[model samples]
Each structure stands twice: as C-alpha cells, then as structure tokens.
Target: MATTEEIEDLIARSALGDRAAFSRLYDRTSAKLFGIILRVLKDRASAEDALQDAFMKVWRHASRYSANGASPMTWMITIARNTAIDHLRRRKETVDADDAADRLVSSTPTPEQSAVAAGEARRITACLDELEQDRGAAVRGAYLEGRSYADLAESFGVPLNTMRTWLRRSLQRLQECMAR
Candidate 1:
C-alpha cells in the first residue's frame, strides 16, 4: 500500500500527464478501489467496469484533488464509490423503463402470464427466505417497499455504504438461488 504522501505525489504527477505516475498510482490502489466498487456493484464484471471508469475520472480530475482537501486515497475511493452508485442508478432506470413497457403490454395477464408471474414471485420469496434475516429484510425494504438506501441504512443502524453492501450481497445471493 502506498503512503498518503506517495499517493498524493503520484496524483500530482498524474495531473501533469505523467502516464507512469498514473500507472504507479493504479498499481498501488486498484485492489482497494476495486474492493470498494465490488461492495457496491456485487457483480465482478460491473465492478471491473466501474473500476475502469473511476480510474479514467481520476486521471482526468487529478488536478481537482488538491483543492478538494481530501487525501489522495480518499479522493480515489470517492470516485470509485460514486461511479458504482451511478452505475446502479442507471441500471435501476433501465429496469424501470423495461418494467413500464412490460406493464403497458400486459395490463391484463393471460392464464400463462399469470402462472409465470406467480412462479416468479414464489421463487423470489424463496430466495429471500434463504438470506440471513437482516439481509433479507434490507433487500425487501430496498426493493419491495421502495426504500432509499439512506432510509434503509438509518433503519438498520449501519453506515450507508454498509447497507449498500448488505443489499448487494443479498441480491447476488437471491440471483443465485433463483437461478437454481
């Protein structure tokens, strides 16, 4: 792990367009940053994508880090966190749009559609039941009750990021269970 001063120096050099400095910075920090993103994203592929995006932002915005008064690692973590959250928000929007389209096409479900929906609901419930109690509750609060992350975090008496991690992991578990 790079010391804060070393990271800061690398950020400074990176701001000056030193590709080697940026590469060193990445080598020093990518694992930590990727872990942070993975906690938010759950999916390794999406976390990898977010990590790449975060580094691109870091390269472009290194000049702003000093003025922001955060340590280099802190600044980089913020970038990674925000990038993962943005990815989640975009995914939610896309899901919402798809759901709306599905609704418009199926105001009244046929027998087959109803049966499929019932099976899906049961499968989701079974998956939720497989999770630890609090994780399952957090997943339900976030999805079924339409609770915001902040709201769920506060209710659960955990940090916002911890809440996100719980939900992400829970959802991943649910996905796996449903696939079976």
Candidate 2:
C-alpha cells in the first residue's frame, strides 16, 4: 500500500492535470474505493457504474481536494460513497407511487406514538453525542444507513478489524450511556 504522504503527493499532482499521477492514484486506490461502492450498492453492475462516476468526479474535482481539508483517501472515498448514495436515491425515485403511498399509509404513527418515538430518538442522539465524533458517525452510518463494516473501514482509512473494534467499544459506551 502507498503511504499517506505518497497518496497526498499523487493527489496534488493529479490536481495539476497530470494524467500519469491520476493513473497511479487510481491503480493504488481503485480496489478500496470499489469495495466502498459495492457495499453501498450491493450489486456489482451498479457498484461498477457508481465507481466510474466517482472517479470521473475525482478527475474533475481533484483541484478542490486540498482546500476541502480531508485526507486524500477520505476525500476520494467520500466521493465514491456519495455517488453510490445518489444512485440509490435516483433508483428509489423510480419506485411506483402507489407503493410509496401504501408505505406512507401503513407507516404513519399516532401523535402520542410519535411523541414517544421522538423522545427515544432524542435520547439516542444524546448518547451518540457522548461518544467521540467519528465513532458516533460510524455508528450512524452502520446502523442508520446500513453501511457495511468494510465500507466504513475504507471510508475512515482504518483496517477492518480496527473498525469493528471501534464500533464494538462505541456500542458498549452507547449502551452504558443509554442505560443511565
């Protein structure tokens, strides 16, 4: 694997429209980025499409990367993730309106029930806030958004096991906080 400094340098060069640098960066990072897209999309064809869209964005937006303040890999992974999410949203928009209406009708809660749910949501948010910011965000991504551990690891630039450990510890902390 390329070191962080090497990746940063490659990104900088790519920002200057150096095709060779962009090629090198893609060779080094495509697998990890593809894994992230696949986790979000859960279909090889859709993931491949999303990955292509993400790299196209990277090619176009590399110059803005440094100004964004994210580490190079994180910035790229965010692009891939957002691309997959946008694709999913577009797919969802194509769902039959009748199905959506049925879902809305079946899922509506009474005002009293909504109040209780809102209170629970507030408690959960408070507990999440008590954790470190990254941990809290990871928890939200995994549980709320259904992101896989592999995807979270790639996005956070951590090893899979390390991501799992972070989540395990964070969940324990959240459980403790919620219990209180």
Candidate 3:
C-alpha cells in the first residue's frame, strides 16, 4: 500500500498529464471509488456513470487536490462523492448532504455485512416467495426496479386499480414479515 505521501506525490505527477501515473492511481483505487459511488447512487448503471464522471474530474482537477488538506483516497472519494451528489441534485432527486455523508460512512459493507445484506435479501425474497407469483413479480418490478405503479400496471397489462391493490397488499405483507 502506498503511504499518503507517496500517493499525493503520484497524484501531483498525474495532474501534470502523466498518464502512466494516473493509470497506477486508478488501479489502486477504482474498487474503493466504485464502492463509494455505488452506495450513494444505489443503481449499478448510475453508479458506473458517476464513477466515470468522478475519474474525469480527478483527471482534470488533480492539481487542485492538496496533500495537506486530505489523503489521496479521501481526495479521490471527495471527487466521486461530489459528482454523485451533483447528479442526484440535478435530477431533482433527494439532496441531503448529511444523508450522503452518513452513507459514505456506512457504505462499505464488509464481508460480514455483505452476508447480512444477503440474508436480508433472502428473507425478503422468501417473503415475496410466499406471495402469489404475479403479485410478487409486481412488487419486485415496482420497488427493486424503481418502476412507478402506473408503469408496472402497464407492463403487467393490468388495470391501475388492480396494480394499486397488488402494491398495497405487497407492501403491507413485506412490512409485516420484516417486522418479525
């Protein structure tokens, strides 16, 4: 692992249009960067997009980054984090900086945390598993995929009222199961 000083030196060199140094920096930090973006965006496609934007900023504004102010990883993460938050803000999505900060702290799920998330996913899957197949599918379409109720109704070829009922019941059931 590179010390903070070594990393800052590399970043400063990269800022001067050193492609090889930049590549080395990216290699050392992409996974951590991607993980940070993923937690904020919560969508793989959006997170990947944000990661690209963040790296571009790092490339362009590398000179602005200062060693005394923040570590290299912290500087890179600030770039990534700000880029992601900017997207959300421009999209008129939630714009809570504190929430984003909290997420940054909690985002990196460890192996144990991953197992817990998987277990929760499994339990939720099981709960959905217990629902009528169509209803379960409808719930997944709306919540997991971020589809609106109307969109889900149209996709399922069902009446809006029916879709509403399905969503309502599915949410109630999920809440009940999760509460246990």
Displacement of residue 176 (Cα, Å) in model 3 is 39
TM-score of 1: 0.56
The 0-to-1 C-alpha lDDT of every candidate, in the order given, reads 0.76, 0.77, 0.72
Q: How many backbone clashes does candidate 2 have?
A: 0
lDDT of 2 by residue, 1-180 (tens): 988799889888988999999999999999998988887788899889888888888887777766654456867877777777767656755533221111112234566765665555558889999999999999988853546788799999999999999999999988778656
In candidate 3, how many Å is residue 50 off?
A: 0.6
- Ranking of candidates on lDDT, top first: 2, 1, 3
Per-model TM-score on C-alpha atoms: 0.56, 0.56, 0.49
Which ranges of candidate 3 are over 4 A from the true structure?
Answer: 93-180
TM-score ranking from best candidate downward: 2, 1, 3
Worst 10 residues of 3 by lDDT: 97-106
Give the clashing residue pairs of candidate 3, or none.
none
lDDT of 1 by residue, 79-162 (tens): 777777667766666532221111112134466765665566569887888899999988866543346788799999999999
* lDDT value for model 1: 0.76
State the lDDT at 66 in candidate 2: 63
The lDDT, on a scale of 0 to 1, for candidate 2 is 0.77
